[model samples]
Target: MARYNSWQNRSLIRAAEALTDAARWQDRGAFFGSIAATLNHLYWADALILARLMGNERPQDTITHSLTNPADWQDYRLLRRRRDRQIERWAADLKDAELSGTVVWYQAGGATRVTTSRALCAVQLFNHQTHHRGQVHAMLTAAGAKPDVTDLTSLG
Candidate 1:
């Protein structure tokens, strides 16, 4: 799981870096408007799920709050680097026992629900990242930017 997390983070970072040459803040038809916004959403969603798993208060009120306008490529890259480090650290320190426990939390819509385990929550977090990143990649390509290779084996 840790290995997969590491690879996913690296893959996300690489893809984001590849788009640096394109417009960083311009809306390229992504749901979040721009690459920066889409990537920010991805990071925030991961953090939100991680926080829920650990019984911590979410920093953002809504997932939409995570959307951002990082006009500078360097700043966007730095933020992504930090997020990747956070993901790596979380994955490294995660315990097998914790993965099996139920996570009870309130949904953003104010509904209460219980997750069976952190493992499943973690899977959702990573999967969410991939799903949105794919959207950003398509927007990048449509905007005439060359997206990074997305194959998992290539990431290895």
Candidate 2:
């Protein structure tokens, strides 16, 4: 799944390269409002979830900042690449015992604490990526940028 995440991200970034920055940032009325915003949200969410799974401090930026922190598209791409590598390394080091454990985290924007299966957290990470990427995929296609095949079987 980590490899798939990285591969799909690379494919999307490459496809997005054909568009000008203005086009990528232009509002298309998706959940995050634009391709750039959606990608930013995905990156922020992934980083936070991974931090929770690894018992690290959450990033300082709030959800609102996700759209503008790495303001430049090029910077976003570079950070996303680094994040993908971190995820891959985490997956490689994971042990069976780790998945059986639980992960506890505070609800976003609240003091309430939540606990869930570590494995489920991992599932959310990949699932969230796929969900937003699908949005980006549609937006990209509508904008005339052809993303590569998304099949997991194509990972090879």
Candidate 3:
């Protein structure tokens, strides 16, 4: 799933790169309002969720503020690519015993601490990426950018 996440992100980001800055950031009336914003949201969520899974410090940015930074397409792309590699490395190192272990972290505002199985947290990270990436795929297609196939089987 980490590989798939990275693969699809590469495709989507590459396709998004074909568009003008104005086009990529243009409001298309989607949930996040534009491809750029939606991708930013995904990057934010992935960073936070992956941090949780890896037992790292939770990001200081709240969900409401997730879309505020890395506004430049190049910066967002670089950070996202680096994040994908980090997630892949973490996934590769995970042992079967760790799957049953629990990860504890604070929710968005640090108000409540929640504990969950490492397995479920992993799924949440990947699933959340796919969900929002779909939104980006739709917006990209609407803007006439052709991302490569999203099929997991298509990953080489």
Candidate 4:
């Protein structure tokens, strides 16, 4: 899933790269308002989720800036590439025993929760990426900047 996610994200990044900053930021009425907003939200969410999965904390000082808007394209590209690499590496390291374990977490907007199955958390995490990536895919297509195929078969 991490390999797939990174492949899809690379496509989005490439498509986004073709746009001027203003074009990338133009409002097209998606949930996050623009391509930039959508991507930034994905990264922000990934940071939180990845931190939880890794049992480590992200540098807090960077959260506010990223959640508001991703770093400028060059910076964001670097940050996102790093993030995708981490996800891929971590996913590669998972063991079958770990998949059956429980994952407990807290989201800021609400209370604590537990997943009886770590596999469930993995499912949700990857599904979350696909969900938002679909939104951005539509937005990008409408804007005539659609990336190459994102289907897992194609990625594989």
Give the best candidate by lDDT.
2
Predicted candidate 2 versus true structure: per-residue lDDT over 36-123, tens digit per residue:
8899998988988998898653333343346866779889999999999999999999998988878887766557678889999989
- Every candidate's CA RMSD: 3.4, 1.9, 2.0, 2.6
Model 1 TM-score (2 dp): 0.75
* The candidate that achieves the highest TM-score relative to the unseen native structure: 2
In candidate 4, what residue range of length 10 has the lowest lDDT sum?
Answer: 56-65
> Whose lDDT is higher: candidate 3's or candidate 4's?
3
Off by over 4 Å in 3: 61-65
Per-model CA lDDT versus the true structure: 0.66, 0.88, 0.85, 0.78
Q: Write the per-residue lDDT of candidate 3 for residues 89-131, one digit (tens) a residue.
A: 9989989887788898877678988888889988999989999
Report the C-alpha lDDT of model 1 over 1-156, residue by residue, as the tens digit.
Answer: 445555654555565565554565677766888777787777677667777766764334544445763556677667666767777788788877878866666667656555556677778878887788788777767766665577767656
Give per-candidate clash totals.
0, 0, 0, 0
lDDT of 3: 0.85
Model 2 segments more than 4 A misplaced: 57-65
- TM-score list, all predictions: 0.75, 0.93, 0.91, 0.87
Q: Output the worst ten-in-a-row residue range by lDDT, candidate 2.
A: 56-65
Q: Name the better of 3 and 4 by TM-score.
A: 3
Task: At residue 125, give the lDDT of candidate 4.
Answer: 74
TM-score of model number 3: 0.91
Worst 10-residue lDDT window, candidate 1: 57-66
